[model samples]
Target: MNEEIELKELLQKNKMYQQVLDDIEIGIHVVNAEGKTIFYNKKMMEIESMEMEDVLEKNLLDVFSFAQNGYSTLLEALHKGSSIKNAKQTYYNNKGKEITTINNTFPIIDKGIQIGAVEIARDVTKYERLLRENLFKKGNTKYTFESIIGSSDKIQEVIDTSKRATRTNSSILIIGETGTGKELFAQSIHNGSNRMSKPLVSQNCAALPDSLIEGILFGTRVGAFTGAVERPGLFEQADGGTLLLDEINSMNPTLQAKLLRVIQEKTFRRIGDTKDREVDVRIIATINEDPIDAISKGRLRKDLFYRLSVVSIFIPPLKERKQDIEDLVQFFIDKYNHLFAMNVKSVSSEVWSMLLEYEWPGNVRELEHIIEGSMNLLEHEEILTYSFLPIQFRNKPQFQSERNTKKDLDEMLIQKGRNIKPLEEYMEEAETYYLKKALKHHEFNVTKAAKALGMSRQNLQYRIKKWKISKE
Candidate 1:
């Protein structure tokens, strides 16, 4: 019978079985229910630096002190009648070299009762080494323009234009809403330029006060001012490279004039010093505001705008390119899997639909944060559910609802005009018409409408509802 032959083969455990184990790439060990070592592959014996005779009658735990934890693990698995696989850890070899390995273990059952454990260990030293050497690994400084993840036509066009702009050393100005990855494009330009190997100093013009920003942009000379310390500014630090000026629209006009001079003449004077310092730092400035409006409002200078706009790169907002949402979700999920040490593998269709429908006013940064939050809240299962998303995303208002509300207001306005009560009444009707149009254009969101109209939300809402207009 097959059972008799199988039992005989298992009981024999002869030299042929040892030969098969020795030929495997992974290490293997077989122990009795009493945790005594009965069989070990050649690789395991070599790693332990022991001869077959020495290990023959010895308990595995007593022979190898490092394997005590493994014995506990085996006992737990045997008690539960379940297999424990892929227990990852780093172990020392015979030469005392650390090697990463994954242990795949199964219980040896007899007559439906758990007995001992057989463990197969596969070395993952090279895999871990490859993960370390990856350019996209955390804190790696090798990111270039190519790291921008998008295949949309608009994004590709922006990349092409940015590449052309980087080929020259001309000053570049990137304009986009917040969270639009302006700095990513700046880094790409720097890497594509001849200054790839040189330092790319970054300065946030809006994060510091005027005096501190000036000091950081232009170095201060020691002994030239009271308690002044000598140090090179960002311009000097980025000499022969690039200096990114983030939030350039928020910078004062005085600083704008000074920056314009540096870009035009390649020279700047440190604080409390008369002599000019020569530098070859390429300028890459970003602004969330429109340059024309910024210059008109006197927050920026026209000359500086002209100087920086010679090569302009504009990053489109996320809402305009709805096609990228799916890929971005997958990318963020993969990122969070490694970051959170999770097994989460898939997302639900309902979650994807909710993502596609929501108006991402905060752009890609917001999406990334949402994904991270979702991953943190998810349990051990491999699927991401709709409930994991933010409440606002799940309940996004439909476009038809918006249009229906707009039509209601338009009909009310026309009905008032048809009455022909007085010239003042016509004026009132026209004013309400335009006000409702403004609100509708801004998604009937009083906060956004108020901001666009330069009025408070309560004031705008009072006026609209006073006219008996329904937001729905």
Candidate 2:
């Protein structure tokens, strides 16, 4: 009698869940405590390449073929009454087609009794095949101004400035966090400018040692140093074009002085060579962090910064341009759909919510990666759902907003149920803390602290008195 009731409950569960599970992006398979298939969604059927009649009520081992004995994650979960997550499983289907999947399996327990197990599977066969082919190193380099993807006001501001900059050959500085597409803006400015026909050469300041870097920027004459060749540096090679100095803050201060002179004079001497060569190259530089912080740390020379920033363009981070996420998401989905030859329509509302809630520390690049990865795991479903998200996103809370994380601060602002403090009051308190730290770091030397903080000593003194900030 108990077995009959359990079977009835299983049938009801299969009917109730099939509609929801079949609509999700990943595959779903469920089995009974006795290892008999209880539910198989459409996605699972396509993933395993098996018929409904062939799987339902049939033993898992009898329906599927595994090269290794006792290798079924579903069977393990059912027997052990345990949960297995994010395990990569490889096996052949009923038709002998090799399949690769990332599986998350869990047991269903009723009171103290183990009833069955459910397994979620994501196919990664094509993604792994692409990795083995070594086809990722050479990416398409041609990026036009249209290639930039954003419609936010902050982004449009930079775009407008960059477009105006293309009309002039003045040195330009592009600033943003890493993965924020600094190179894209630089290439766009170059491609749009009159120097479009000329060659564009770029060198990373942080990729080599100081000694080797100088030689790289300014060509070395034969016998200039050990194994030195008669090679022309980036400046000579990029003559009449654009030369990109990437992460300029990482360049040595001395090298920066030489660079400043070259920008001012349009000439540079090769190492161990008596003669100087002239290049009419348009200079473009990028800083992967705040230029003000770079100056404070003495990583970038003040004079060099002043020169390079003649036409400054700042690319806002993903957080600062939340309005663009939807556009970028659709853009990448369209992009990967073409590359992977799949027809994924869109993400479900639940999945969409998580994308916006994410802080996006890696900015647009990180979003692109997450989207590409999710696309790789799609089954027969057209829309991406919660099931298709990465394990990190799946395991985390249901997308906490930035404001939600600072509830304590909000409470302090409304203590005793008083009206909240004005924005400037909070700003003043923050300034007070910052000034005190700077003063203490400089051992109460107001002049030095003011210089390091990029403010006039008199101005800092006035604020220090205004906030009553002191060593004590």
Candidate 3:
């Protein structure tokens, strides 16, 4: 009976303990003072692609060659009886598949002396995938309620209201200035809503012609119109999903009535078809203009406005959300870093102050362009200075419409006997004028003219073809 009790205790401490390790999802392994793998779990076995018999008593470096750099670092940590957490690691298997992992290593202690070490690692492949989806996936329906990245209370209220309305299927209307990301809010509403699992189809009503818009919204029959190729409209395509009508105010009044009918009856008729099709698409419309004003201006129908105004959301302009500028700048910096394949580390404080002080009349889109242009113009520098920005922006213009004041410039040209000139002819004349000035500056040297104007030899040759100018 005593012998049986001793056997039970031994099994509980060793084999039973090993069974507990086997049950865990984390890869658990023990390494001796010499850095040989003394014991390993089933999880570790899978990671190393080795059997228990194959891995035991194997040197950590011999078993995993990629761990050579990490072995010395981990040994130092173990010698000091300290624990390392969340360390990044990568390994290549015999099949050459790269596996990324997050590691936690703790020094094993017995009798107040460091003996060896126990390491635990969790495979981060799925976590990395989720991160990628969150960052880049257009259809991702999951983001934090506060992730909309606006500081204005007006904008915050829109986010708050959207969150409250997520439990219902009420249609949303997001109003904002151009480039304010109205569709971004619409997507947030769809993702937050109960019907998140369904699709979200977007259409810019203004981008399509009136003839094509109706068929695009309602779909078409095999012979819907002259040379009518059958195609599904926004309603049918978004069935059991959400339909976003971007620039809704720009949609034709006739189509507006059809859309109102669909919203009211949840049914629509395909062009050249007698049958009405039922659909379950949630409607979200965005307009850059005020709906009340739009109705008064004959831009939108009052009845359609009332139907969409059930759940209205208004996004504030970028200037109002000034506090979010830094976060947004960082967000774009990280975004462009990967996109442009440059290692931009930071933006200078002076450049940031310049960004803050300037009134962003064009909002986030303008800021994004400024940053992108700066990245393109500058080399691989650690800091982005204000001087790196475009010359037009460095001098900075006061708040004014982006519309050309240069309409008079065209009129002036017409009055100067240039009215009948073709565009290419005008371009050729302009190029010749500039080329002559540059050549005078360079004493009519072709190489000098090319270098001074930042034009390549081949580009200069092409311009000369259009210029019809001779060096003689």
Candidate 4:
């Protein structure tokens, strides 16, 4: 009788412990050595669209018969008595709905005896759906000329030139430093043109190797090469539309020659086929370096450069357009405020001064990131201050070279002396700066940032909370 009572108490304790796991968002499942389910959580039922009665006490492989072939992480873990982490699995459920999950499966061992296996799953169906929807079907553009956020003469000049280019079908070459919104101009020009209803396909020339880029851009024919199948390339896929070739200088000279022929003749021959396939695709190529420098260095062919530069546009860097910094900062703050569901109303004078002084090497993208990082850290505070800026901005060494002369340094020192604050205030600002910079540098990946900062993740999280830093 006493043993029976003890068994019931132990089961009650186990149920109490399992309740915590049941409330989590990730799906959890456990099956014994016999493959019969011992535990199933509410999230698992929701993820699989199944009821508890249908899964509990059922054989794991029998419940998910698709896994009976020993291809699933659960089955692999059961057979190997080892852990499998982040194994991506795709299968159809009983209702014929395709499900994809990133799963972590591991065997559960009690003492030296194998007891069961556990599996945790995270659903990524919505993410995949978004990717597919954006890649095809709609052929819609997300940004137009209005999305370009600057009122400076230089920026307005580029926007005006881009607008003019939209009326014609001539090839355009965009030259700008990294992060100067070259792609933004390309998309805006495409969306504003007569081919707005057609697809606007984009490919980075630097992203693929010479061997594959040809096939991807011009496609292949059946029996063209050893296993070649008939396939439509980007040119065909983008027929009657626009094709934006980003980082055009990175394309191989041989591929450049072929591209030049296509640009001039308005036709291309597929690999392994002698017949020519004509395509009407408006070309917009972007280069992150000076065209002359690229040609001189042999990274870009002279003839190809001339062919592409018929209509050229240059976007100035952020440092060159200091007049637009305030406007850009406000734009980003508003954007992130909407995204993060916060009410950040104003920027502190100290922060504004700091922003103006810093030379943004990453340009507009870097400014956007800085604003985003600051907005994430905002809590109840309505005003953004120097304390919210990243460490890269607070440190002198990072911006000392940009000060340029002794006069500038002296003026900066005078400004600092006039604005002398309390030691505790300075220390707090320093801490917040380092924390924000670390988080930003790691792309808001808390685990990696915590490791780099030489602190435990939990402790860093606590500090983030206390400092009102943004995690997302």
Off by over 4 Å in 3: 1-147, 151-154, 398-472
Best-to-worst order by lDDT is 2, 4, 1, 3
Could you tell me every candidate's TM-score relative to the true structure?
A: 0.57, 0.56, 0.56, 0.56
For residue 354, model 4's alpha carbon misses the true position, in angstroms, by 1.6
Put down candidate 1 lDDT per residue, 1-472, tens digits, no spaces.
9999988888778757778889887777777776666777877665455677766666543344221111334444544667887886543333333355677778899997767777777767678646644643658565577577665557778999998887788889999989888998999899998999899999888899997889899999998668889988999999999999999988998888899899989999999888998999889999997888888898888999899998888899988665566546656776777777787755664465456556788899999988988888887967788677666555566734644664785666566546645766756675577677767888888866654443335445546865777665
lDDT of 1 at 342: 81
lDDT of 4 by residue, 187-273 (tens): 999999999999999999999999899999999999988989999999999999999999999999999999999999999988888
Winner by lDDT between candidate 4 and candidate 3 = 4
Name the 10 consecutive residues with the lowest summed lDDT in model 3.
398-407
lDDT of 3 at 204: 95
Candidate closest to the true structure, highest TM-score: 1
RMSD of candidate 4 to the truth, in angstroms, is 21.0
Candidate 2 per-residue C-alpha lDDT over 316-376 given as tens digits, one digit per residue, 9 for 90 to 100 = 8988776567657766776777678787766764565567656788999999998898888
lDDT of 2 at 326: 65
Q: Each candidate's lDDT (Cα)? A: 0.74, 0.80, 0.73, 0.80
Q: Model 4 off-target regions past 4 Å?
A: 1-141, 396-472
Across 12-50, the per-residue lDDT of candidate 3 in tens digits comes to: 799778888899999987888766778889998776566
